[model samples]
Target: MTAPRQRTLFGLLPWPERQAVAEALRTETIGGIVLVGAAAVALIWSNTPWSEAYEQIRDFHFGIPALGLDLSVGHWTADGLLAVFFLVAGIELKRELVVGELRTPATAALPVIAAFCGMAVPAALYAVTAAAGGGSLDGWAVPMATDIAFALAVLAVISTHLPAALRAFLLTLAVVDDLGAILIIAVFFTSDLNLWALGGAFAGLVVFYGLQRFRVRGWWWYVPLGITIWALMYNSGIHATVAGVAMGLILRTTPDKGEGVSPGGRVSHLVHPFSAGVAVPLFALFAAGVSISGPALAEVFTSPEPLGVVIGLVAGKILGIFLGTYLAARFTKAELNPDLAWADVLGLSVLAGIGFTVALLIGELAFPGTEAGEHVKAAVLIASLTAAVLAAVLLRRRNTIYRRLYEEETLDADADGIPDIYQRTLAVGANN
Candidate 1:
């Protein structure tokens, strides 16, 4: 008797999980357009004749004196509103860890290794470039992120008949990337830690966890507790966004008996729109407004820090992700899905370089309130655009091939009175 064929990495997702992933990609597609549009507007407005007006608005400050929360408009968007974006990311990460792609070692190993290598190679590239130029190494983490929204949007624009497994692989890789970015923010970006406030934040997290454990309901309770934890975390001198992710991870991903959706799912659904549509775009509106003159553009390439960022995002990401995936498949029991070609993986790896949201955040944290920071932001835009264009060219070619294959398959299915793809999916599901 012949041995049964083993399931491959990036194999077909379960029907329900495939649907959920598709729904998320749809939402992120729209959000990504908005985000790019917002960044474009900021870039235009900042470089126009009325640039001073833009600065005046961004630098405008207000706050609650009692809370010690005075901040500029830019700071509010970056430090406050961006937390909501991270909250949604954290919830997604929790879901993946608890019951989705990352739940099993066999399923998770490929993406996990790929993500770590993706992060490591970029950081190493940045460090080497900066060191060669005698530049500061603080911005090492800036290129380690893959903006899922921007990446999915790019895929949606360039692809029509790409394998669903490729999309799933990208999603899982980006989720792991987000987790690494969150940890970098929490550990590397913090300053002047406050023990008392940190203790308070921990206590608030405990309460939040207890409520979930006891099956507490109502947004009212969570809203206040979440705010308190975020505030305490901010005062604790850790990045305040850590609080948002902490609360998100604390929420239960699995539904209770008789409940249709899990609390984490419901909360993510409710908050994701605001996070994507408003919070992230608003953050981009403020954060992306940098000088883009001829001299400023020259500085991005001449300056070691920004140059490192560009290299890290555009080149290091591709080498790291593709090599990692190849190594995993070659050495481990993991196998690439037969539906996907190595060329498809290469395209997806290039797509992974479109870092934006968390990349900009890290640029600011790395070189806070300085000219270098602005230059790094400009570099991120330049590198991301470059990567997007390259990935688009590659994926569009693969998409055409897949479209042709799809048409041929459909024709064959018509002759047989059933779809070959559906049969394959059913067979895979039964085997698994």
Candidate 2:
């Protein structure tokens, strides 16, 4: 007899699809581990007796002074190096829009809605708390971000048996969250507009677009152009990282004739390693090195800013995402993927509260060089750690259930070409 066809659910994707997600997960997991290690080292070093040395290294400046480039090591890591991470983000965003799950409205609705809720609810919570306590409202956006590397790393460790669709959902939600953070930085956190420099940045972006249209093929040719665009954007009032995203979006997403890879894919492939392994870790190192002495810890507890941030990240993220997902499904008649459960979504949503990277950036922008800023940084670190611990505890239980399901989906018996579970499923469906 011909073997019965298997039902594909979010729990068990097709092999090729699973392979793609697995590879992406592997990359993010490694990067996440490195990023976390760097942050931990920074925290330890900063709080130790050698804290001044860490500050000295971070504050050392050596770039050309004439070109307005005399930035400290910390600034360079934050502004220059982190652009690589944003570039990869932009490329991934484009791919999703053009050909991935986000290509269709139906597929994109849930995560997009959840991402929006995730951002909005956190901002509202922070604002309300900050305002009620007579604290500055500047850092409201700090809690609105989801650190993809940190979250994915946590997932990789605790959710090894989770469905591929869950990974994809988290990835897409985080990407959208990053995009929202970028827009906030550009719009609300900008300095006074510098029109001439802004115009120059746009001109460079146009040229960069033209280069891609002409099928320009080498990293060497694009590097200088990318730098020039970054410089112009830096001089513009907008954050320079937006330039990287613009360039990334400008690159073609699909391969040209006789080409093995698209420009976007090629650039991402070349830059991801550097961005993940070096740039992000270095940025985390500088950004995370906040001294947390007894006094500092006391300040974190007494400060309204940290309290708001903590609540926003830990409580706001989970409630917002779960409610948003439910509302989206309810109003749109979009069913949750068959292989996943509401409980799985709840666990993943809780894990999403681990906001580290962009939260630190916004904290700096919101309260630069102030006591409040330091408190905000301390709060982010603490909140992320809390979220990580909570997620591990919650997801560990769910992991056992998923592991059993995963095995059932993969196991074949009776010399059949199909998994025995699927055969039984098909037989049950036929009887029904």
Rate residue 422 of model 2 by lDDT.
52
Candidate 2: how large is its RMSD? Answer: 10.1
What TM-score does candidate 2 get on C-alpha atoms? 0.89
Question: Model 2, 99-165: lDDT tens per residue?
Answer: 8878888888899999999989988999988888989889999999999989988898777776677
lDDT agreement with native, every candidate: 0.89, 0.85
Per-model TM-score, in order, reads 0.91, 0.89
* Model 2 CA deviation exceeding 4 Å by range: 1-26, 407-417, 420-432
In terms of lDDT, the best-performing candidate is 1
Give lDDT for model 2: 0.85
Error of 1 at 111 (Å): 0.5
Which residues of candidate 1, in runs, are more than 4 Å off? 1-26, 421-432
